[model samples]
Target: MPKLRVVSYNVRGLKDDRAALGEVIRDLAPDVLFAQEAPRRFRWRHKCAELARSGGMLYASGGLPGLGNAILVSMRVTVEEAWGLRYPLTPGRHLRGAAFARCSVAKVPFLAVGTHLATDDTERPAQAALLAATIREAGGTTIFGGDINETEGGSAWRTLADTRTDAGATNQTPTFSVTNPSRRIDALFADKTCTVTSYSVIDTPAVRRASDHFPIYAEITL
Candidate 1:
């Protein structure tokens, strides 16, 4: 069996202390990283690559096409396919989408999907539905990570939860507004194809200085 460490974080467009963000990422040391609000315009690719480099990982997929969602992988994983998806846009709302990569860790294959959803309560369900459908269709073991923009039990959260097991169910600690954390808006979900051995929230000085939301990750066996 192959076990992997998957991390999810909302980088706040890397507008904060990037070095601090890098430090947190380096410490967590993810095999697969799902980044939200990654640079979306103006040499976005370079910025995404730089982010991966800073974490000592490879830029696997996503960026502008994923509407700022991205996936970065450490050298241990071998990427086979990579792509992005954009959801139906609602007028006057920020664009929403997902990043996907089908990869193998120590020869065990799995899918990694990273995303961020709209903050508007009414807008998230549809996006969630699409995301759930895509995950179901993706097949095999999966590690889903993202900032859902709402806490658990919300419609969007439920939609996706119904489609997979919430890795954080056992320890639902908050991940937002790092300095004054109050919500668990970020998450990592694992499909039945794998087993989540542990879930964690990495909160440290670097995390607070890195972005508005703290980083969350899960260790799973496939």
Candidate 2:
């Protein structure tokens, strides 16, 4: 079986403490990192690009203004396709987007989607449905990760797996409010075709100071 490490983190627009951020990534060494609330400015993207190169990961970030959601994968992984999603309720601003990257871990091809959903109950569910549909259309074992901003048992959470039958959904272990560490706003959902071996919340006190939301880590066998 082929296993790969993945992480979903909201970097807080690169405002995270630099040293802590670097250390977190270095320690985890995730094959794929999905980051939300990342700045969209050129300087910000350039800085992230630099980090991706230096950290041995490739980055794909392009959407609307202000902290565009992004996906960074290891050099060994290949991004075959990508897409963006816009909400009908919110439109133009507060735009939420999702991207699907086709890649392999240890030569095992799999699909990974990076996304950040809305806070509104109805909109969030609709967005989740759209993403689920997008993955089904793509046709393969898929994984979705990012700061969903929704609580456990919420409509959005419910909708994520509503359209897919071959998939198993896992609420990412708690990852939020690095300082206090209360709710779990982040998540990682994978298909039944994918086996989850382990899950972790990686936002130690030091790392918490780096960003508001901690990183959710998981290991999957394909």
Candidate 3:
């Protein structure tokens, strides 16, 4: 069995305390990191690379191409393929997309998707559907993660729940507005083939200063 830790976070476009952001990320020591709100313009790629290196991880995929999503990986992970998808346009809505990678850790393979759904209630369902479809098309034990911008009862959340295990649901940890911390918008959903070994919302002074949302991680075995 191969056990790996996956983390999902929203960096708020690197407008906050980046050093604290790097500190908390390094502390979590994730194998795969699903980052939402990555710098989307003006040297975005270089910024993404710097962000990944800060945590001793490699930038794998996503960023501008995925709208605001990005994925980073630890050295132990081998990335076989990497790509991104921009979702269909809905009038007046900001674009959204997903970052994907076919990766293997310790020789056990899986597909990793990093995404950020629409904050507008009207746009989330379609984005969620696209995410699910991407996972289906990729066809493997998939690790889906990032900010869905809704609660467990929301339609978009339920749509994703239909095909994957909510690795952080049971913990019921809220992950938004670090100052208040009352909403649970960030998550990690894994295929049934993976067993959840442990899950947690990484919280500390550094995490609070990192971004508006706290990062969540889960230890899953495949």
List pairs with backbone clashes in candidate 2.
38-67, 167-191, 167-192, 168-192
Which segments of model 3 are wrong by more than 4 Å?
none
Model 2 whole-model lDDT (C-alpha atoms): 0.71
Task: List ranges where model 1 is wrong by over 4 Å.
Answer: none
Model 2 alpha-carbon miss at residue 137, Å: 1.0
Q: On residues 187-218, what C-alpha lDDT tens digit does candidate 1 reach at each position? A: 89888767899999988888888999989988
Sort the candidates on lDDT, descending order.
1, 3, 2
Cα lDDT tens digits, model 2, 1-222, are 777788888878767686777678768888888878765666766766766764567775433422367778876677766655554557544666776667766767788777888866667877777877777788877877877887767877767755432122354445778767778878877777777888878757557666888888888777
- Per-residue lDDT of 1-222 in model 3, one digit per residue for the tens? 888888999999999999999998899999999999997888999999999988889999887887878999999899999989888888887888999999998888999999898889989998888888878988989987989999999999999988679997788889998888888988899888889889998889998888999999899897
Q: CA lDDT of each candidate? A: 0.91, 0.71, 0.89
Q: Please give each candidate's TM-score.
A: 0.97, 0.86, 0.97
Clashing pairs in 3: none
Question: What's model 3's lDDT at 94?
Answer: 84
